[model samples]
Target chain A: MLPTLPLGPFIFPTAGLVIIFGAWFCLWVIEKAALRLQLDAQATYTLAVVGLFAGFLGARLAFVALHWPAYQQNLIGILWPLTSGYAPLGGLATGIVAAFFYGRARQLPFAATLDALTPGLILGLMVISLADFLGGPGYGTLTAVPWGLSQYGVRRHPVQLYELLAGALTLLVWWRLVRGRRYDGQLFLTAVAVYSATRLFLDAFRDNTWIITNGYHGWQLVAFAALLLSLLLLARHDGNQ
Target chain B: MLRTRFEWVILIIVATLLGSAWIMMSQEPATAGSSLLTLAEAPIVGHPAPNFTLPGTVGQEVSLHDLAGQPVVLNFWATWCAPCRVEMPAFQQASVQYNGRAAIIGINQGEAAKNVTDFGAEYRITYPLLLDTDQQISRLYEVRGLPTTLFIDADGVVREVVIGAITPAVLQDRIERLLAEAGNP
Candidate 1:
C-alpha cells in the first residue's frame, strides 16, 4: 500500500489526497444530483459546504477538548495541525445538525433533499473505504482465492475493493432503477437497502474487526438489520404511492 | 426501471448470489497460497500481542511475555524520527505516572544500545529502553511508522494503536482505558 508520496518540494499523504478528491467528487455529485432531482442545486451545494466546514471545526475542537490537559500548557498548541487528533463522531453529529438546519431554513423539501443527497453521501462512505485501503487499515482475513491480494506475506481478501464495488453497484442501481421513483423516499431507501444488503454479505470476508462476542461480525449484523428496516420502509412507501 | 417490490428484491438477491459465487469459485483453499493463511497471522485488535524478548540498555533483559497480568504500552521509536523525539517526553511522563499499574516499554527500532541509552540519558527517561538491533520486534508487530504506540490490555490483547506522536492527554486517556481493563489482572 502506498502510504505517502513525495512530489518535488512537498510530501503528500496519499490518504489525504484521496479524501480531498473524494470530497470534491461528492460535492460535484451533490450539485448535479440536486439539479437532476429538481431541487435547488445552489442551496444544496451551500449546505454541503457549510456542513464540511462545521465537520472540520467540530472535529478539531472536540479533539482539543478531549485533550484539554495537554493544551493547557501551550494554548497555541490547540491549533497545531500536525497533531491531527480528531473526534469523528463529534464532527459527524455536528455536520448532520448543520445540514439539517440549513436545509430547513432554505425550506427545501425534506424527503426530496434526502433523495438528492443520497448518492453524494454514499460516495463519501465509499471514499472512506478507499482511504482505509490506501492507509492499510481494516484489512480482510486470509484467503485462498487466486484473486486475493498478497499482503503481510499472505494472500488476503481485498475487503476495501469489495466495498468499493458494492458502493459502485449501489450507485448504478440508483441511476438505473431509482430514477423516476414512485415516491420521494424511494430513492433514499432503495439506495440504503441495496448498499446495506451488499455489506451484510461482503462483511463476512472481514477478520477481527467489529466482530463482537460469539464470533459474529458486528457490522454485518448491523447492516442486515438496517437492510431489513429499509426494505420495510420501502414497502410502506410503495403502498403509500 | 425496478418499480415493483418484487423487482427490487430480485435485483438485490441476484447481485448477492453473483457476488457469493464469485468469491466461492475464486478461492482455492487447497492451493499452496492457502497454506500461508493462518487464523491470526497479522497483528490485529483482539489478537494476542506477539511475544518477543529484547535486550535492554544497562545489562537488563526484557521479554513481553513477562509483562503479562498488566497493561502494556509498547512504543516503537528510533534515534531519528522527529515525531518520535517529540513524544518521548510524554512517554517518559506516562512511565512515571503509571509506574506499577501499567508498563510502557520503548522498543528502539534497529538502533545500537549505546544510542538508545544516550537518548534516554538526554531525556532523563527512567523506564527501560529496549534495543531492537535488527528491528525484528518492529516487523513482528507490523509497526508502519515511528512513534507508533500499541495499548494492550492486561489480557495481552491489543486494544488500540496510535501512529503519531502522542500528547499527554491522549496518553493518559489511553492509559486510563488500559488500566480500567486491567482491573482484574
Candidate 2:
C-alpha cells in the first residue's frame, strides 16, 4: 500500500507534490532553453504560467465532459482545488495551444519555440507518469510478468513506469535531435509520434472504467488519431521551415 | 495605456461586482432552506428514484420499474468501497429473510464486472446485482457517499435513503413496515 501524508483529518497527496515539482522543473528547464535560444526570458516565464493555468482548466473541462454525471450533484466539489481528474492528453493539447498563442503574441517563431520547449515537455511527462505511479488512479492490467507491481490491492503491470521509460527514451531522442540540429521540427514530430505510439501500447494495460465506442478505450482512439495526424503534419511541414 | 482616474474607479467597481457574483454562484450552500433538506441539503429521500436499466448479474435483465409492484431496496455499492463490503452480508441476510416481501437490488458502481463478481464470491451476497460501470445510476441517485441505499415503496415513491452501513435489523424493519403499509400479507 502507498503511504499517504495527512494534515489533520485530510490526507495531503504525495502525488500533488510531485506534480508541483514537475511543473516547476519544466518551467525552469524551458527558461534556460529560452535564454540559450535568445528569446525573451520574461515572456517564456509568462507563457509557462499561462500554460499551467489554461492546461489545468482544459484538463478539468475534458474530464467533466466525459464524466458529467459524476459532477451533476456536486459541481462545486468537482471544481475544488485539491480534487484530481486531469487528462494528460487534454492538458498537453491545451498547453501546446497556450504556448502557440503566447508565442504569436510575443512575436516568437512558432516552430523554433516548439523545438525549444520539447525537452521541458518530456521532463513534464516523466514527472507526471512517476506521480501517477505513486497515485492509485492510473493502475494497469493484471499480468504474470515478473516486473508487475501490486498497487492498492491487486497485482498489476507498472504501465505508468513503462510510460515514464518511454518518455525518457523520447526525451533522449529529442535531446539528440536538438543537439545535432539534424532536422528542423524533428523534436516536436518525434515527441508526438513517440508519445502516441507509447500511449497506444500503454493504454492496453491501463484499467479504464469506461469504454466509449468500438471496443477502444477513450484515450486510445485519441492517441491513434493523434499519431496519424502527427505523421501527416510532419511529412507536410518537414524541410519546408 | 493611460486611463483617467474616474475611468479607473469605474473599472475597479465593475471588476469587484463581477468577482462577487462569481464567488456567490460557485460556493456550496451552508444551510438548508426546507424540512426535506438535510445538512448537506441533498435530495436523498422523498424524491422519485431515477429509473435506470442495467445489466444484472448472471445475464439477468434488471430494471427499476420492474420492481415497482413491490417495495424495492436499491443499494449503490462497489467492489472498491470498504463500507460496501462491510454492509453486504447484512443486505444478503435481509434479502433472504425478507424473501418475496421486498426486492433488494445492488447496483455496482464504477468497477469492472469481474472485480465485482470476485467481491460477491467473497461476500456471498445473493441478490440481484446490476453492473453500473459508467456510473449512470450513481449519478441518478445523487450518490455522494458509498453504500447508499434507497427504500422505494410499492407505488414507486422513494420513502427513505440511507448513506452508510445499515444494520440488517433496521433494513428488515423498514421493508416490513413498507410491505404492511402496502396491504401485503
Kept native contacts, fraction for each prediction: 0.10, 0.00
User: By how many angstroms RMSD does model 1 differ from the true structure?
Assistant: 5.5
Each candidate structure's TM-score, on Cα atoms with residue i matched to residue i, is 0.80, 0.50
lDDT of 1 by residue, B32-111 (tens): 22332353534555456788998899889998889998899999999898978878888888889888988989999998
**lDDT of all the models against the reference?**
0.79, 0.68
Q: Residue A28 CA error for candidate 2 (Å)?
A: 1.3
Candidate 1 segments whose C-alpha is farther than 4 A from its true place:
A3-13, A63-74, A81-84, A212-216, B1-52, B109-115, B133-145, B152-161, B179-185
Local distance difference test, candidate 2: 0.68
Q: DockQ of each model against the real complex?
A: 0.19, 0.02
Superposition TM-score, candidate 2 onto the true structure: 0.50
Q: With candidate 1 superimposed using the best TM-score fit, by how many Å does residue B89's alpha carbon deviate from the native?
A: 2.2
In angstroms, how far off is B160's CA in candidate 1?
Answer: 4.4
Query: Candidate 2 residues A105-139, lDDT tens each?
Result: 88876666776677787888788788767743465
CAPRI class assigned to model 2: incorrect
lDDT of 2 at B90: 64
Interface RMSD of 1: 7.4
Candidate 1 DockQ score? Answer: 0.19
